[model samples]
Target: MRYVGWTILITFWVALGAALHYTLPQRDVVRIVRVFEERQDLNDWTRIFWSRPDEQSDTFISRDVQFLQTVRANGRPMVYRNEDTGWSWPPYFKFDTSNLFTEAADATSTRAAPEWYVITHYGWRNEFLTIFPNAISLRQVDGPDASKGIPWVNIIILTTIAAIFYAIWVRWRRFRRARIDPTLEEIQDSWEAAGDAVSEKRGRIRRWLDTWKAK
Candidate 1:
């Protein structure tokens, strides 16, 4: 039982961490190599990674998705999907897809004259699954090494989650103390009192029988 309890606890935490990691916005300082629009078939399971730009478009299985190709400081290639979240999940409220595409196109640079830009995005890149992270915002930086800016967004999100959990725990403790524990104590006291009353009745019956036997 103890082992099972520990395993469940560990699994819950691992899943929570992975969910936060995938949902939270992260920064990647890289050089934009190219920006292009490609028509992608969104009929399969990978469709969840793409954005829904219009309500009527949900009927279509394929659509054009803007992409930003970049090379990280470590020379690894990274691609980001530029799509408006449009008051959807993650709540980025990004509707300026055209402006973002324009900015990315203008920011394109070669390896020799690398113009570093921080891409603020959320999601995961899995080549096997063909899923790319959705870019939320971007801004030019002085250089690739120039302070990879702090993740204030992630900090705020984590702090809020912690506060929520703390509040839930406090409420649970109060409920247990104020309601659950008191209820259990009352039940226990009633059981003990009933047992004592039964014992007193049994003693009186024994005394009455003993008096009859003596007579």
Candidate 2:
């Protein structure tokens, strides 16, 4: 039971960390090589990986998904899906899917004259699952090195979340110390006193039985 409790706590924290990492905005420095749109299947199981209209997400179907194909500075391929987040969980409010696609298409460049771009996106790119990160926005940079920008937003967000959790934990400890601990201690004292009284009564009964046996 103790092991089970520890496992549950670890799993919960791991899931929360994964969710936060997926939803948080991440920037990547890459060279845009191609922009293409392809029809994709929206399966029931994979619905969480894709962004769609809240109503249509429940009923699965096929739709055209715009992809921005690019190569990282290390020559690794990175493909991003352009989509509208609408008024949803991560709350990017990205309704300009077509606009972003056009921008990606316009920004495409050849390897010789590679134009570096930093794409601000969210989600995970998994080949096995065929899930791509949704590009929130992108901007041209001088070079791969120049694409290094300070993530002040992420810093502030994480700090604020930490402060909130810390505050809650502190208050919970205070409440336990002030109220719950005293109540539990009192209950334990009462239980021990009752047990002692029962033992004393049993001793008297045993003495009476011994006296009767002697007579």
Candidate 3:
């Protein structure tokens, strides 16, 4: 029971540390998208890109076009798309000139823009912030028509889980150490005393010849 208690306490501390260390940026992607929408006033130009009136179906169908318009409206500083040959607009084009942003392409088929597709950008390098400004910059730099999902979703999830376990393991170790029967110093002193007692019983002459006697 005592050992268990110690383990739990140590585990708690370790888990706390790991939890702090392994924090994930809270779903910034959605927040960033919202910010981009608001800053860029995407609603105004959404019609120019889509032209359709319906909400769900139209929005889904026109995502590529709308995204493209947003990038272009933002000064074309930081977005791009994969323009391939085939259906209407492009096939797949990587944008991010700096080579730091990751892109994913979404394929959408329509007569107006055959190659039209949505591209999502993620994993942008911090250095590009000077020019791009926000997450939208990365999307723009890469290309609007590009359709890629955010890159690190799985990695973030795994890292979070690992952090939790790591924290637990660390606390457990700390607890175990705390519960140990004899501390390092105590063990060391006990051994030293035993040696000194043996030497002292040997005789005065032996003690004098010993290292302690010399000191």
Candidate 4:
């Protein structure tokens, strides 16, 4: 009974916390650029799309699309002046080079130029890669990414539900065993051990046995 009460209390607190999270305005920016990738036999074209903070619709930008085209044609890396600096790409795709679009910029790249469309914050860019690992060409909502160390409210809700059911099951099991074995100590031991046992018929039988024994 005590364990059950504690479990219920814990579940309530968890549920309340999750509700708060869902209701609160998202302080962290949920930004993602929808890179529409169209891979053809000859070339792969990618259109860059960006979303402002909590914006309903996304805006299209062509920085990545142009870079991809230029890189594909040149075979050598094309330079873009980004943030008053210049950067080059490797012949092959490396994990280090994967972030080239976001951070480094070429000396010739202008901050206000069309070429820097995909050069937003790393957070937004990562949001894009998370949803569309192999995305071809289209807009996609950036769903939750578990690996990013962000606390997911959905996971918390599920865990709370599981805890509630588990508590109920354990309590019911203890209640049943107490009648069959007819002892408090044994019931306590079994209840602690079983941790998840609940049957309606067993409960009814336990009640009948208790009444019969009492009479």
Candidate 5:
């Protein structure tokens, strides 16, 4: 039972971390190799990775999605899907998909004269599932060696969440200690006092019965 409890606790934290990592915005420094558009069938399970440009049109099952191909600093190829998040999850409010595609196209460079870019995106790429991270924005940088500073957005978000949980935990402890614990203690003391009173009454009755028998 102890082992099972630990396993469940660890699993919950791991799952929470993965969910936050996938939903939060992340940045990648890479060289834009190419930009293009492709028609995608959104009727499958992979549709979750895609976006709904029109919030009211739930019947549309397929659409054309723009893509940006890039090579990371480690010489690994990475692809990003350019789509408008609209008023959906992650809340990027990205309605400039077309403009972003044009910018990515203009930033495209070859291996000889590599133009590096800092691509701001959110989501994950799973080769087996054919899901790519959605590129939220992009900007040209000096080179592949350019320093993409720390993720302040993620830091702030995580810090705020931690603080909220901590506050709740502290309040709960105070409530338990100040109100709940004292009430339980009072109830226990009253029950013990009543038991003692009943025991004393039985002892007095036995003493009275012995005196009558002696007479």
Candidate 6:
């Protein structure tokens, strides 16, 4: 039971970490090789990975999604889906999918004179499931090696979250120590007293039995 409880707690933390990593905004430094749009099917399980633009009524199985094709500093490929995430989970308040497409188009550059841009995005890319991260915003950078660190916005958000959780845990421990521990101690004492009384009564009954036998 102890091992099972630890396993459950570790699994929960791992899942929460993954969820936060996927939802929080991360920056990628890359050069835009191209930008385009495609009509995608959202009828399958992968639909949750895509955002519902402007909280529109969900009736369409297919919609047009803009995409940015880019090559990272290491010459590897990275593609991002450009979509609006208005009034939704991970609320970016973004409603300029078309405008972002225009900016991406203007920022496109060649390998000889590569134009690097830092893109703010959220989500994971799973080629097997055909899902891509949604690019929240972008800005042109000096070079391909502009910055590879996690954005400061994400750092602040994570720190705030950790502080909040720590505060709650401390208060909960204090509450348990102050209120619950005393009650539990009282119950334990009552249980031991009851057991002692039962043993004493059994001893008295045995003594009476011995006297009657002697008579």
Indicate which candidate wins on lDDT.
2
What 10-residue stretch in candidate 4 is worst by lDDT? 82-91
Encode model 2's per-residue lDDT on 1-215: one tens digit a residue: 99999999999989989998999899999999999999999877787899964677657588888999999999999999998999877788888988999999999999999999999999999999999999999899999888458888889989998999899999999999999999999999999999999999999999999999999
Report the alpha-carbon TM-score of model 3 versus the true structure.
0.27
Predicted candidate 1 versus true structure: per-residue lDDT over 27-84, tens digit per residue = 9999999999999887667777777766856777888889999999999999999999
Prediction RMSDs, each to the true structure:
4.3, 2.1, 17.4, 18.2, 4.2, 2.2
What are the lDDT scores of the predictions, listed in order?
A: 0.90, 0.91, 0.38, 0.35, 0.89, 0.90
Rank candidates by TM-score, best first.
2, 6, 5, 1, 3, 4
Ranking by lDDT: 2, 1, 6, 5, 3, 4
Superposed Cα deviation of residue 191, candidate 3 (Å): 1.2
Clashing residue pairs in candidate 5 are none
TM-score versus the correct structure, for each prediction:
0.79, 0.90, 0.27, 0.19, 0.80, 0.89
Candidate closest to the true structure, highest TM-score = 2
Total clashing pairs in model 3: 38
Shift of residue 85 alpha carbon in model 1, Å: 1.0
Two-way TM-score contest, 2 vs 5, winner: 2
Prediction-by-prediction clash tally: 0, 0, 38, 12, 0, 0
User: Candidate 3: misplaced stretches above 4 Å?
Assistant: 1-147, 181-183, 202-215
Q: Write the per-residue lDDT of candidate 3 for residues 69-168, one digit (tens) a residue.
A: 2222232323322111122221113233223222222232233333322334322222223111112223222333343455475477668878998999
lDDT of 1 at 45: 76
